[model samples]
Target: MCGIVGAIAARNVVPILVDGLKRLEYRGYDSAGIAVHTGNAISRVRRVGRVAEMEAAAAAENLQGTLGIGHTRWATHGGVTEHNAHPHISFDKIAVVHNGIIENHEAQRQQLKALGYEFTSQTDTEVIAHLVHHYYQGGVSLFDAVKQATRQLSGAYAIGVIALDRPDELVCARMGCPLLVGLGEGEHFIASDVSAILSATRRVIFLEEGDIGLLTRDSVVLHDKNDQVIERAVHVSDVSLASLELGPYSHFMQKEIHEQPKALSDTIEAVLENGFAAGLFGARAAELLPQVEGVKILACGTSFYAGLTAKYWIESIAGISCDVEIASEYRYRDAFANPRHLVVTISQSGETLDTMEALKYAKELGHNMALSICNVRESAIPRASELVFYTRAGAEIGVASTKAFTTQLVGLFALAVTLGKLRGRVDAQAEHGYQEALRQLPGSVQHALNLEPQIKAWSDKFAAKQNALFLGRGLHYPIALEGALKLKEISYIHAEAYPAGELKHGPLALVDESMPVVVIAPNDALLEKVKSNMQEVRARGGELFVFADLDSHFSESDGVHVIRTPRHVGVLSAIVHTIPVQLLAYHVALARGTDVDKPRNLAKSVTVE
Candidate 1:
């Protein structure tokens, strides 16, 4: 949930570190800091607020160096103050910047205290600084010192280290968090994310788990945990800097919301051209996917919701049983693994810590095959899986996901159709019809986007409300859940979702004129059942806001407001219905005057447990 960028270059690296942190600012942070080897001593500057404030301080100090590391902190183990910022130094010997949490930091701090080492900040990262500095004594080299120090740390970490005396080199290590070394001409770099260094270098070496890297002005070396030399492939990143630009939009969230149409087209174009097949997932998918008797999807947050939406499709269309689990909770529980079950993991960044751990645990329990639906191809989850489907929804900088979520749905629906065809559940005519719907999905999403003006009007009234209720029936309850999540995530509204049939069970007691109810009313078999539930809400004076299909024949009435969407695309209605709810959340947050891109207490990626 933090950002780390470092460079050992021929020219001054203070500007490089600052620029990298600015690019990484889309990942939410509360404090920014950087430490550089100034040829005399380590010059460290930290600020409690934005990256701009820290940049101003560096300019005032005239900070300059050839080697440096910078960090933007999200306050995991300490307060949001300047003293709690990163680039933590010890004995003026070494400065360290870290991304993940240290589970055993308290024990390490106490042991370091016994060695007469004084600590200043209340951060777990300070212990890392002291450990590296303490090991750099008695004729030990900087490379061996970092390697030995990392052997004792017991948690996820992606660290960048710079020593006062070693001004020409930088050291970095990765365990569970994502880290990479960027190779350049006459220079080298290290960063927790590739986006930080996209402007400087496109060639990158993504370090694997338990790998430590040593970077110098001219050479890059990598080693495994046993201190033996290792080799990893270097891949040029495909993310264009132009995609990172918010050209015409005020916020990245808004930009991503409007980009959903093109994003859907890019993600499903392969399905449109080649038709749905098991081979589309990967080379091994044809051999492994046909053997699948059950599916268990492991994901977190928005990806978990995507799995929930997929569950309805896989079961109904594919005629196969599917289960979705929250990856964080699945880690501590006992799972009954079956050899024929396909364990699927979904993540946008592909570096979600708990989901990766859960996949490992499933494999440990005798699950033989795994697949990943991810956006980043080189990320941990995709490499760890036997098969993968990459979503073409490029870099999602907004903390609240928009394009990434919808693209996951597209891949999931494709997977369901592929499985259905393989298991003899779907005939040729049905498969062709599904393919047509897949091709029309982009146009349908664009049709939903046309409701933005009406959604904005509803948001103006929703901004004054304190709570909201979202309702849906079969095949779309997950959409309602996602809608309620989006409302609470950005707009800061207390919201909840329930299957419309469950209204009388308990939630109906909260209904009043002050409460707003948002309904997902498409023209499906359950529409009449949902309408009866709407009548119950209207009887209790609860205002109703319905996103209905064009053919649903819904009309505005007392205490009821209807916004008609485009006609539903048969199997892709859930994805189309998702657009309006996302727009409502964005416009509502706009009406509330909140930060739409970086919401409070949330980061674009969850790299820690």
Candidate 2:
């Protein structure tokens, strides 16, 4: 996924746009470009690297304009080179910045070439600027040209166009990707995400599919594909710009990992204050609890792990059968869903492509009671669901999710406890106790984060290892899997996670001194079984890094490195346990000199198949 930002200000907007692009750099970092409209022409500057390079090049020259659009590209349609960078210009110098894929661009290129249009770069976005120029040359208004060009294009796109002739206007449109309009004082802004313009304005208008936004310094206009004017309202975002900064951490990943406590606590507060549990079933949860026969949790990546944790909570606490499936696979499978079944989708970026598709498919199959636990408001996933519980984990920037995953778990736990109380499985006193435990989660997470020094001390041991294995049992199995994923994703290490009992089935051969086995050995009922598995690993000369509760009777005599965490309840332990593992991955990656923010061959958002 690419990040796009446009501004039409009364004063110079290039600097503001560059600053906004820097804030939105987490979206994409392959290349960066900017297009600003001067008095008579559109000035463009681009480079094939980080935004800092583009800024350095721009600073060497003067790029003065009051209207412009900037982009940080992830390079899906072309390679990472200067020629493949964004702000793809037409023969007449019309510039465009795009965020999504054009599926039929090859055929469009052939048709345009036949009409005597020459292409400079091998980018699908280049076709859009040429297409727009073709329509404008044939006597069409700028808005009319974009409308005509988009009608012929197939697939998803959120595009911003700036023409030489129209210096005051910026035309933008969205299909399946995200786009938002920020309302400011005598200024207007457009961005792929709200963080880009959060500093300029709090009021924003989220563009829907087929809605076109025409931005100017004074006003913004919305129109349908049919060219009919439409009225749209603005929503003021609750997130502040300060929330996006890294504060004192070395990386966004570290800051986000530490923010888990506050994130989870805020989510708990929101759920209680907004009556979200009561909102789930509409009639105080008791009337509808008996009717729910099954639950299907759909998500992708780290959110999928959250669903796995939720499955355990729902089955154990609420006495409901539950299954967690990856959204990409869930959309294609033969789903046994009915009106009595609930489909819950978890996503941090609610715009995740596969999760959105799965939510839409489930709705089409007549699952009326669908719910979303999403961090982003007004995203496609929330729009596709019948109900939503927003996770107040403010903008997560790191590619590997940290705070968002933990907050989703908190929300799911709240839902499970509410349903358990409603269905007579737990009394009010027990529900209150659980709620009180949730209230103290933020403090617990802060305490867990205080173990950073110890975690860093063990970093060299992990950095020297070639492979790692993570093992856990019961609800902690998913945490083990997620810990392994974080290590592999950022450090480029070969890591595998297994349910401790499953090690004997196949994974035992891989245990050796060259491998570090991470055991999630919280002092739960399965602690003994997990410790037995640890012994098997030790017998095979596997280096051990065990995360255990303070009072757990795990011995350190077997050359195992034990990191003790504060004793927490079974339901809230996942939140605390995730912190040390995340810190371990962060320190290990840092020790190995890896690019912790943008890992190789991976983009922040997977918008395309």
Candidate 3:
């Protein structure tokens, strides 16, 4: 993913474009560049590092303009170099910054070369600049040229363009990628995300697919695919600017890890207030929950692990057959679709491309009932689904995803209890007990947060290790997978997870003193089996790091290190266990001196396939 920003105003827009690029830096940071319309031509500055470098260069050049567009690139089509950085200009007239892949860029590049246009950069985004320049010839306006170029492109994209000829105007379009138009007095802003321009304006209009936006200093307009003027409602974004700031914290990942208690509390309180009824999902959830013959979940990355955790609860607590599929893989395969099966999609940013496509594919296969569990409001997945549940985790800035994962589990747990009650799988007393346990989770999570000191110490040992093995059973197996995922994501350590029962089959060969084995052992029915697996690792002279409960009775020894949880958190232990695991990954990354918030080659949101 790449970040894109554009601004048109009566005052100099250099600082505004730079600040917007800074806010969007989390989306991409490999390279940065900007194009500003000067008196008679476009002035450009490109750098192969963070936006700060580009800002320094722009200041040195005294780049000044009333209209501009900027970009921070993640380098999908080219290497990280000054030449590959965006704000690709054509004939020193048309400048463009773009996000998402252009599937037919090679073909377009060949045709542009035949038409006598020279290329300066090895990027698909350069094609947009050349194509726009080609169409803007023979008296075509810049806005109409951009609209015409969009019709010839394939794949997802969000492009922002500016021309020296039309210095007071900015033209942008989106197809399958996020784009927003921010409203301001005598000024307007365009960005890949609302957070990038929130300082300029709280009022925003989310541009749908195939919609083109025209922004000027005094007016904003939207045009549909057929060149018809369209009216869109302006939404007031409630996300506070303070949420994006890291106050008294060294890194965003650590801050998000510490914020888990409040995040879980916020998510769970919504369910407690609503009494865990089917209506908690939506008004039609009561009618939909009772008619479900099976449950199918589609998700990707950390969200997929959350779905794996829900599969255990849905089957054991709700007495329903559940299958969890990776969204990217699910979209390409024949699903053996059944109309009676309920399709559920999970995503932190509801705009994840693979998950959104899978939701569309499921709907195409005759599934009438669809549900979405997401954190973002009005994202594509929620709009495409029939019912929706929001995880009130606020803004998760860390690329590794700390608070969003735990909050998704909270929502899934609520869904499990609600389905259990409706299907006669859980009695009234048991349902009430589940509710009481949920209410106590906020305090219990606080107790889990207290273990960070010891986790940080354990991370010292982990920082030196090159590999790790995580072992768990039943519902906790998914948590082991999540723990392993977190460690590898930020720490860059090679890690793997296996169901404890399968240790003797194959994973045991990798166990030794050099390979640390992390175990998730809560006092559940499968605890004994997990303990035996731990013994197998110990017998093989493997170092064991166990995250257990007070009732689990696991003790520290020469080869084993035990950190007990507050207590066995019935049914919700998966959510509690995730906290310490996240802390382990965070601290280990710190000890290893790796980038915790923005891991290498990873984007916070996977908006491209």
Candidate 4:
């Protein structure tokens, strides 16, 4: 969930490493640090603060070097302190900046302490530095030392290392985490993400599992587990630099929330032109979709919520049994292996380590027909899957996802309609009607965006409340979960969601005047049931914030605030309802003075379990 950037170049790379970390600031970090191989020794500057502080400290120290590794750390092993920051050192011989957990760090730390290696930081990453130093003391090269140290480690990691003795070379490796080698003119870079080093190089080699890379100023040598040289495809990242800029917006969350319309349109452009078919997922999807009898969706966080919403559409409309499992939990349990069941993985950044591991676990259980719905076209999950669908929600920098969630719904809905048609669940006319509705999806979402002013005004009053209850019924219940997730993620308000029918089960006890209740009451089959639940809240003096359809006839009253979304669009109402919900969360965060773009302890991509 942290960020890593290493640069080997002829010119001073301090600025490059620093700027890379700044670009990656959206990935959420509590501390920032950098270690540079100076003229004769490794110089380090670690700070328990933002990138700007680290940059200033580096400037004060005149930390000039042609090669360095930098990190923005999300605290994992220890407390958020300078002592636990990255750029962990080992007797000043080796410095490592790592992203992801080292599962067996305690064992390594004990062994290292026994071997007379002193530790300065309380971090799993420090074990890596010490282990590499221990191996290098045997007169082995840094590359072999890193490889040996990595062999003893268990768990996901992407590490960039610099040795004082090997200032000319930087060794990096990845195991179950994303770490790419960026090829530049007379320079080489290693970063956990392509966006971090986009300024220095667009051409990158995405390392595979157990891949180790040795980098110099002018060349990069990659080797697989057996020490045999390997070659992976070099992908030219098309992430425009402008996409990273906030432009007129105050935060990335705001920009991404408003960008959903175009993002949704682009995701379904191919489907809109050629009609919804199994081939839209992939050329082999037609062959695979026909063989599917059930579906198991594995995802995490916002992507998991998207899967929950998709389950309603697939089961109700496509007439297929669907199950949504948290990717992190999927590996812990023994799944009922069924080869005929289609395994679908959803992720905004295909590099989410938990979901990727779940995908591998699903494949191991004889479920080989895997499909991925992801935003990044060249991400690992899509590459690993037999079938893939891109969300086209380009470069989501916000830690709390907006466009990515809505766009994933678009892809999932398309999959539902395609499956419905193939299974005879939907007739030709019904399929055509679904297509027409999809064609207007972008416009419908845009119309929902128009409710932002109303939502923002309501947020001024809602932000004062500390707890909230988001209620919906049937198809809209997942949306209520999503709405609650958004409010708690960005606004830091305690929020919970429940099926409207289950309000009296337990959640109703928490509702009172101090509690704000957000309800999704579209004019679906259960609109009356949802309205009854709203009355239940209002009768208890619980303030109500409702996002209802224009046809629902919901209006503002004493302690009740209503924002009119577009007319209900059936299962697609979930998509339209998401916009106002997102806006409310964003504006509430603004009112509460919380970090909307990078929420506390949350990373844009969950690359660690």
Candidate 5:
């Protein structure tokens, strides 16, 4: 994933571009660069590190301009270096910043080389600048040249272009990646995500696939692939600027973990008011539910775990069979679907490349009954889907997601209950009871968050371990997977999750005193079976960290530490039980001196395959 930002202003633009890049730093941080059109020429400054590095260079040189494009790269096609950084320029010095892979760059490079174009960097993005320069040399306008160049390129891309000749205008286009235009007074801005431009302007125009926009200081013009003019609608965002800050917390991850209580409460409040379900999903589900035969969920990383959890919720509550598949893998599979089948895609960033592609593929298959549960409004997932359920989690800056994941679970849970009521699977009394529990979830989640101190204390004991095992059954199995994933992602610990019953087959041999086994033992039908598996681990002298219900028979002992969670029923318990494991991973990583915000070789948004 990479972040792109551009601005045309009546005043100095370099500072604005750099500040935007700072807001977008979470999307990518490997390298940073900016290209500005000064009075006489295009000035380019780039460095192979954080945005601060490039900003230092810019300040040292006193670079000033009123039009510029900047980028923070995550290094997909080439190694992270100055040569591979963005704001890549052509021989004529025109610059471009891109946020997606150019899949057919090799062939384009070969053709350019045949035309005597010399290459300077090992990046697919460089080919775009050269291609634009190639067309510009033939007397095409900069806007037309960029449009023509895109016709020769293949694969996903969201590009912002600026040239010396067109010093007053910045051109942008998107194909299967996210790019947005921010509307302001006497100024216009473009960025890969809204967080970058929110301070300058809350009103935004989201660019669609195959759509192009030309930006000037005063106006923005939209056009389709054929260069035909199109009307653009402006959407004002409701996210407060304060939500992006970490406040008094030590880290973004810790702040986000603590924010879960409020996030969940907000989501529950939004979903459970009197007759809110009828107003929100009643008519929509009535129109779409009877036509749906099954569901296909497309997601990646933590959102994929939420999808897995939703599979249990939908099947058990609505009597609908659902399949959860990774978006990257789902795009390549020959899965069968029809107009009657619904596709549900989950993404926090909504710019996840594979998940976006999967949504595109489902649309191509004529599955119009599409629903997206996303946090960011006007994100690509919401743009590509037929219906959207926006998560109320404000802004999740931590690379290891906390509030976003829990809020997504809440959204999916609400959707499942709504669907169950619409399909007659839930009687009125049962629906009311479920709604009451849903209303109480926010307070329950706050109580769960209160258990963090206990979880942090437990994490102190296991921070030195090199490996840990997580086990659960039924709906909790996905919770186990998510817990293990969090530990591995942030703590750099080698962790694995298995169904408690599968322990004896292979995972049991790895158990010993040095190894820690974490079990999700909420009171359920499978609790006894999971308890037996815990006994097996104890027999082998394995240390245990169990998240169990207070009424359960499990108790704390010397070899075992028990974290008691409030009692919850059905799939809701899995949601409540996940908080402790998330806190454990957060605290463990904190204790181990790991970079919890930006883990090694990980990006917040996976925008490429």
Candidate 6:
């Protein structure tokens, strides 16, 4: 994934472009560049590093212009170098910045080469610039030139273009990747995300697929693919600038971890107002949920783990069959499909490519009832679904998700309660008890956060380990899987999670003093079985680290270490158990001197499949 920003304003836009690129640094970029139209020529500056490096280069050049487009590249098609960076100019007439793959770039380049046009850099974006320049000379204006160029290209793209012939305007188009236009008083802006232009204006217009926008200093005009002018509504963004800042924490991950309590409270308070009723999901949830024969959850990565954790609750409490599938795999496999099933999709950004594609595929197969548990309001997944539950977790800047995962759990648990009541598995008294327990979730998560100092000590021990194993049974197995994923994603540790009963089958052989085993013992029905698995590890000279409940009364032995948590909160135990594991990952990454926010080769949102 990459970041793109374009501004056509009354004042110089170099500073605005730089500020917007800095806001999108969490999306993971290796090189940064900008091209500004100086009325007669396109002045370009490119650097092969972070935005700070590009900022210095821009300052040294003293680049000043009223219209410009900037990009932070993640290096998908070419090497990470200054020569391959964006604002790929062609014929020295137009500069373009793109945020997706051009599947037919090779064919386009061959045809353009035959037309006697030369290329400068090894980027697919250069082809787009040349195509527009070619069209601009064929008795067409700049707006029609860019629109005609986009029709020939294939695959996903969110492109921003600035032509030297038209210095007062910027043109942008979107097919699959996200692109939004920010509305200002005497200025207009374009960015890959709203956070890029949030400081300038809260009002924005999210561009739909196949929609092309022409942004001038004083006006914005949108058109569909068929060249018909269309009116798009402007929505106010609720994300504040302070939410994008790191405030007092050393890293965004740490700040997000501590903000879990507030995130959980805000997400659950919406359901409590509805008294955990079926209508809480949406208007027709009560009528549709009871008619559904089964439920299918489609997600990826951290969102997938949240769905896995809910599979336990939905089947146990609601007494309904539920299946969880990876979105990328579910779209390709020929599995069971029925129109009566409720297809649920989970994503933090709500723009995940695979999850959105899977949801669309299910809908096309006649599954009309779709639900989205997501964080962002204007993202594509939420718009594609029939009903939505927004996780008010605010802006999650960290590459490895922290607060979003926990908030998704809260949303899914609320869905379970509603479904349980609809199925006659839960009565009014039982629903009230679950509701009260949910009201205490914020405080319980805060209490779990107090165990950070101790978890930091465990992190010090974990920092030296090269391999680790996480063990859990039943409902907590998915939590163990999530914990292992957190450690591997941020800390670069090789870790695996298995059901505790599988320890004797094969994994126990790898357990030694050099390997550490983290156990999730929540004082449930499987506590004794998990304890027996721990003994198998201890007997093999392997060290043990256990996060047990307070009532479990686990003691520290010669080879075993235990950190007792607060009392378990029934179905909410999985949500509470996730806190210490997240703290462990953050602290371990800190101790290892790794990039805690943007891990290597990972972007915050997977916009490309």
Per-residue lDDT tens digits for candidate 1, residues 1-609, read 999999999999999999999989988899999999999999999999899999999999999999999999999888998889999999998999999999899999999999989999999999999999999974597888888888889999999998988988899999999999999999999998899999899999999999999999999999987778999999999998988889999999899989998999999889888888887899999899899998999999989999999999999988999999999999889989999999999999999999999999999999989999999979999999999999999988888999999999999999998999999998989999999888888899999999999999999889999999999998889999999999999999999999999999999999999999999999999999999999999999999999999999999998899999999677789999999999999999999999888889888888998
Cα TM-score per model = 0.99, 0.96, 0.98, 0.98, 0.97, 0.98
Which regions of candidate 4 deviate over 4 angstroms?
none
Q: lDDT score of model 6?
A: 0.91
- Worst lDDT window (10 residues) for model 1? 137-146
Q: What pairs collide in candidate 5? A: none
Model 2 ranges with Cα > 4 A deviation: 225-227, 271-276, 280-291
Candidate 2 to truth, TM = 0.96
Write candidate 2's Cα lDDT for 295-315 as tens digits. 889999899999998889999
**lDDT tens digits, residue span 482-577, model 4:** 989999999999889899889888888998899988889999888888888888998999988888899998878999888888998876889899
Candidate 3: clashing pairs of residues? none
Best by TM-score: 1
Query: How would the candidate models be sorted by lDDT, starting from the highest?
Result: 1, 6, 4, 3, 5, 2
Task: For candidate 4, give the lDDT of residue 182.
Answer: 95
Q: Model 5, 119-152: lDDT tens per residue? A: 8889999999999999988998888888999999
Give the least accurate 10-residue stretch of model 2, judged by summed lDDT.
280-289
TM-score, model 6 to reference: 0.98
TM-score preference between candidates 4 and 5, better one: 4
Candidate 3, residue 243: Cα displacement in angstroms equals 0.7
